[model samples]
Target: MKDIFTNLYNKVIGFFQAEKGDSSKVIASNRLKLVLMHDRTNLDTLTMQKMREQLIKVISRYIEIDQEALDLNLEGEGDAIALMLNIPVIRARTLEEIEAIEKAEEEELAQKAAKDAEEQEDAEGSSDESEETEKNTKDSDESGNAEESVISEEEANTEENLQNEETNETEKQKVKKK
Candidate 1:
């Protein structure tokens, strides 16, 4: 009766839906494109301006740049979008200056890598110490503080199963007594 009509309606809807593909998927794809466009263009005017200013400052330091003639814009070329930077340089930088800048950048990167490696080592050492402490506690609990005893996976599983059975038996006995 009602069930037959509902089933027919569902079948018809599913057939049409399968034929046309999912409308929600199309809507989601459109929404994602819009969000990506917004992100690519730096939708926040303040952030965009700040980033442009930062770029100008950094570029000016390397060469004699004409700030007023600089162009920073997002351009669409076919399916891809690119952030194009057109900076007019007042004068060409000397080779010595360029080499100095490269050397400084390399030094900075090397220092940063060393610092990162030291931090990683410190993190790993601390984690290892904590893991050792945890292992000590677990070993002490299992061996009753006698010594570190290595048990096989099968033995550990069997011990766990036996403990569970004992607990179940105790619960059943208490229930019976009650």
Candidate 2:
């Protein structure tokens, strides 16, 4: 039946296919150990110190690290050398935390802008009120000056009438004496 043919097909495929495991990792580790052993045997202490400094500088760009407690070593045994590195991070912020910080900054900026706008409006309003007060004072002063001029003219007319009456009385007395 169909089941028997399927089983035979699977068996034939399994017989020809190779097994899969950590063979690539094993090969990489062996090659790394051999290369490190050969290179570290001839590398001077100054060169290793330089390498450690460079590594620290490169790794510090992405995280807050404790450089004073960092460790870098090249351990060798027989013909095998292992390069090891350990770096301690102070804190790792997730995407949400970073976004929260950015949001807080934006809110602070918006609040400051609103406060500045309010202050500016108050200042302009006060300036406008002062201008209106000055205009009102000028109008009152002009009306007071007009009233004073009219009162002075009336006093001058009254003085002229009193002089004319005095002259007429003197003429009548002269006519009676004649």
lDDT of 1 by residue, 46-146 (tens): 45455667897678657978765566666565579877788868996788887787788789999999998986777687867766776798877856522
| Candidate 2 TM-score, C-alpha based | 0.29
TM-score of 1: 0.35
lDDT of 1 at 79: 75
Q: Estimate, for each residue in 11-96, the C-alpha lDDT of model 2 and write its tens digit.
A: 88665552533356666887787567647678654455557668866565445577655666667787666777877789765677
Error of 2 at 141 (Å): 84
- RMSD in angstroms, candidate 2? 50.7
What candidate 2 gets wrong by more than 4 Å, as runs, is 1-40, 93-178
Give the range of the ten consecutive residues with the poorest summed lDDT in model 2.
Answer: 14-23
Count backbone clashes in candidate 1.
Answer: 0
Q: Candidate 2 at 145: error in angstroms?
A: 91
